[model samples]
Target: FDLVELHRSNRATPPGIVLDPFAERALSPADRGGDRREPPDETSGATASRGGSGARHDRLVALDCSWETAERLVEDFAGVHRSLPFLVAGNPVSYGTPFRLNTVEAFAGALCILGERDSAERLLSKFTWGHTFLELNEEPLARYADCADSTEVLAVQDDYLAEE
Candidate 1:
């Protein structure tokens, strides 16, 4: 919940996971050197319930600027980058549009895919239309959550697009 403000010229690497769709890199479990140990069964502990390790400690960073300025803003960043799968926006300004989520919705979607549902819901609850985003993307969110890696996420995203 710590918010660090940075000037556009500042090139210091921000700490933790960064959600940047335009980033050249994509986040994957393999980037963490691969968790070779088998994941516990679904009926087991928090990791099982959450569908993954749920051990992500990097604070997720998101750009709050306009789409036009977003890419330029994060151009110098060198961190773990992840792009959310396709999901429709629920905000009044961008309702029904795909991949145009406001900060809250984007964070929520990212969190959901990371197996952090409670955190996602907490972020979404801040906005009146937040629940709407979740409602509209429930199936895709669930499917994305089940993906083992970014490659799998891309496959699921492709499937969703094909159906659309």
Candidate 2:
């Protein structure tokens, strides 16, 4: 995972799908046409877990700043930006809170929705509380993963929120 310190360089370009709430575009499997490219086989490892179509050469970018500053900072990078579907945060700081993921959690959630389960698991393994996030949001994450577009994602989110 290449961590780009947004404060360090103004020239840094986001590698792949960016997890930005302020993004105008939504990352969806159908948005890229059909999955014409072959996804990496199970034994291929991390490199095979690139989200979205294999055509794009980039990595998933998650801003690590405070939420107050995230909106502004996210505008600085350019790429395919996507907003995460509604789910609860599992980190101690905001346990049970909805839509407030730390960097690792955000990455994992985004990866899972993008059908990169192995990659998501790999990222979550870096943090002790990672598994908790998966457990807490298992249903929402599964629903979000099945969505073909952002509209479907939003619908799922709405249904989940309404249930609360």
Winner by lDDT: 2
TM agreement with the true structure for every prediction: 0.74, 0.77
Residue 1 displacement in candidate 2 (angstroms): 7.4
Off by over 4 Å in 1: 1-13, 24-57
Clashes of 2: 2
**Candidate 2: clashing pairs of residues:** 15-58, 16-59
State the lDDT of candidate 1 residue by residue for 65-131, as single tens digits. Answer: 7889777665444435566778899999999999898877876787777667887887677778889
Error of 1 at 63 (Å): 0.9
Residue 148 Cα positional deviation in candidate 2, in Å, after optimal superposition: 1.3
Q: What C-alpha lDDT values do all the predictions have?
A: 0.62, 0.65
Tell me the TM-score of model 2: 0.77
